[model samples]
Target: MNAKIIIVLVSVVAAAGAIATFYSQAHAPLERVTEGFETGYGGWAPDADVPIDPNTGQPVDWYVARSTDVSFSGTHSLKFFIDGRQDDGTIWIERKVLLREGARRVNITFDLYSGEESFNTIAVVCAYAGFKDPEHEGELTVLGPANEVAGWKRYSLAVDIDTGNAQEAWVAAGISVRWETHMTYYLDDIIIEVT
Candidate 1:
């Protein structure tokens, strides 16, 4: 009887240990990255799409650079300017992020600053996260209108991708022109998480 009881106790302890190990592995902590654009662009690069000038056949004016005029957290933020006179254009900043080998999900959050709040939709906030870099406006997903708040507003987007064999993902945020007019906006405090 003593031998049988000892064997049963040993088996139960071993099973408990195995369960704990499995639980820990399945509930591993997520990896996070953040960029406030305080010091610099932090690997993020700007891209844009605009209509061509009929006279020159060249794209219209668009600009992206670091500015100190407005920011969400730091003294500096990324500024985007575009001539939406044609009622069409999109501008965004994108970066490639290294991910764990088996990472399956990505979450992105950021803040956008607009000059004033209005019901009129001049531009729409947009974001992207995928294996390939976004090359056109259609590749981006519109999060919401940028003029929702007068100062700064937060936006978030998440994507579930098959990263089993992938090592990196491209993430981006920006705005799309809605009304025919020139527009400028600032972006800052970007956070990304992979799990």
Candidate 2:
């Protein structure tokens, strides 16, 4: 009777340990982005410091039309939408980090509501290392004009940034919606995962 009780107790303890380990691994926090980078918006001012892009007319900073608002601070990010495709004046904070030469997998994940495939915007993920100085250069990436992308899609961008003096990383990631763009669209829970 004594032996049986000891064995049962040992088994229970072992199982609990295994479960705790797995849970921690699954929910571990991602590495934080490097310091000082920021998400910019112009708030719909033709006289704002950052002007709209001539080619796209999308505001370079947080500048939104009537009834639209966007802001991101720290890990908490929010972009309120009033159109099908995400418009200008919406952004998440940015940071600069380092990616050594090797196989780097960047998982860019964001959530969208269930709806039609009407997102007519170009999403770019431009990362620059040595951004503090910029002369040390790193990597610049332009992700997509993905058409069939609708109803909550996630993107995993895998790139091999060669080893060099490029010891920094800055991301200019955003959605560029053009003129006359309309449709109620929303974006939230933006995460940059590195593996």
Candidate 3:
């Protein structure tokens, strides 16, 4: 009887441990951004240009380029430069992604730096989720007016997506600056994870 009790206890403990491990693994944070600035801007594109493109006769987006002068990690960071001259000012980098079912929340994080240490509110980190078919049914969350000076400051936001509908969902995340701020913003190591 003593031997049987020992075996039963041992089996129960082992099973419990296995279950815990599996739960942790299944719930482990997963990177949702297919590419994050680590490899040169990660396919993010500018949109809703304020001024005309001139050549194309279309509203041009903010000028974006990869930079090596400053970075959170690795050798590449995205640089956004804008003058406070445009009439309709809205400058941002956005990447769209299709999220799978069962995705509960999205955690968007990135490192930011500014050229001017002293100034009014200039930059922020933002994320958005939109439904494909309906297009308008989704959420958009923006976090932080990055106030760090002389170095890289990390900013993040966790957005809860309504996964009850089960239709395909689109996720977008990036760095944005208050238009007409007339400042240079550097962004690096942007990462988005879902659980």
lDDT of 3 by residue, 1-195 (tens): 699999999999999999999998798764466444666556677543355645677654566678887877777788866653343344556665555667777776777776655455565555565554222212345665655475777777767777776644545544444554455677777776777
Question: How many residue pairs of model 3 clash at the backbone?
Answer: 1
Cα error, candidate 3, residue 54 (Å): 11
lDDT, candidate 2, 1-195, per-residue tens: 699999999999999999999998655533333221124331111111123556677644342222223222233223323232333322322445455444244444444322355454433222222234222112233344423454544433443344346555444333333433343333434455543
Question: Model 1 misses residue 85 by how many Å?
Answer: 0.5
lDDT score at residue 92, model 2, on the 0-100 scale = 27
What does candidate 1 score on TM? 0.84
Q: Which structure among the candidates has the greatest TM-score?
A: 1
**Highest lDDT among the candidates is held by which one?**
1
- Give the distance in Å from residue 1's predicted Cα in candidate 1 to where it truly belongs: 30
Candidate 2: Cα lDDT at 53: 56
